[model samples]
Target: AKIKRVKGPYGKVHRGFLKGLTLVWSEIREVIREWQIHGQSVWVTGHSLGGALATLAVAAFGEEAKPIHGLYTFGQPRVGGKTFARNFDLEYQARTFRFVNNNDVVTRVPPRNLGYRHVGTVLMFDHAGILQTDLHFWNHFLDRVVGRIEDLGKPGTDGIKDHNMA
Candidate 1:
């Protein structure tokens, strides 16, 4: 089937806004129907385009349907417009997680004007990027108390440099 683009905060569909999400939802259903022949399960996650499709696929699965195993995405831009940005996942019950790096700018594609913020704690990979603020001091103090100085994603072998990309 043919596809048209959605309108994003920028020119249009820069991040696959929900302008035409219903079509994608239908396509996902087709995959599920076809996959049922094997009696297998489906898990969804993505960094960019895959993330957009995952979001729409799970949402289209309906409220009572079994929630997908997990929803993980990195450097994923805003999926919908100004309104969906606020409450799109209100009723959805999936384990949603986003891994964002300080310098990885793909997460803010189109750079719209708004106040949406990542809910998870920032796993600071580079301390140099942070300002010398009171909050930083507090976090360091807490780290000392807990005896865990490095974030889970900050280890030298954590591949932050490789995977912290767009």
Candidate 2:
């Protein structure tokens, strides 16, 4: 069967791919639950569309039984209206770092100030940002400094790919 060209919002000159937001959030929640790691802080990080979607998921968890712990992503684009950032910032009470490379245009779309109240957002502008040497160290360190959250694995090697998150 030939693939039909669906037009409109999901098409050209229109926001054709803005639908299915709820589904994405639902799946993210389910996966976190499946992890079965409760009472231990959580961090939602992603790249590109994953970042926007993950942000939505964290926002959805706001005021729930379990609140979002942190957020760190790269190459992520804007997801919703200006109010989105403001509202999300208000709802989320955690460390949020949004990395953006100068060459990556994905983080520069949809314009800024969407009626949302964001405390602040850190934008990383190079591949060095993704450098993880301590794996999940900074997250744990932050958790300790902030709310005494349970710590994860030991610090990874210096300059290690996963440790750069620190």
Candidate 3:
């Protein structure tokens, strides 16, 4: 993957993702073109790191992303700064759906202090299994592969346990 910094309104972005998208874009475009010819709609979804890639991909696609049936991402880290977020929101017009487990800690990263801001409508999953905006910064490290399941699976688990996307 090529790693060149692409300039966004607020800062630079991961070039590897952009390069990957460029490499695959022709195929994706062909598929979408065929689907559109058949009156079908396009959709995109991703989780964690993939979510960031999906967001970047959609943004890079620009107008091509507008016709997508939906865009959903889970446990995504902040992708860019305020300017990038603003531009993405304007271009996609709420088409992106950022799903955050309110307890998940990963969502808070690249920190706002670093100028990273999220784009699209944030659909937060509160501790109650209901959607809400109540988020805690300590919930991002619930990865099963990292042995967090033991603590997370306990009865009445709160705090970090709630961060598990699994």
- Best of the candidates, lDDT: 3
What is the lDDT of every predicted structure here? 0.48, 0.49, 0.66
Model 1, clash count?
Answer: 0
All candidates in order of lDDT, best leading:
3, 2, 1
| TM per candidate | 0.50, 0.55, 0.69
Tens digit per residue, CA lDDT, model 2, 37-154: 6555677887766776666566656635566678887666666544555666665534777765433445555444432122226554333344223325465344333321112243
TM-score of candidate 1 relative to the true fold: 0.50
Count of clashing residue pairs in every prediction: 0, 21, 5
Residue-level lDDT of model 3, residues 1-166, one tens digit each, is: 2233567433465455456566777787787778878998778888877887788767766744436666799988777767778887886746788887645667777677766678888777654456754344444233222333444556754434545665
Error of 1 at 109 (Å): 2.2
| 2 or 3, greater by lDDT | 3
On TM-score, who's better, 2 or 3?
3
Cα deviation at 118, candidate 3, in Å, is 0.4
Q: Point out the worst 10-residue segment of candidate 2 by lDDT.
A: 5-14
Error of 1 at 153 (Å): 24
How well does candidate 2 score on lDDT at residue 155?
Answer: 53
> The CA-based lDDT of model 1 is what?
0.48
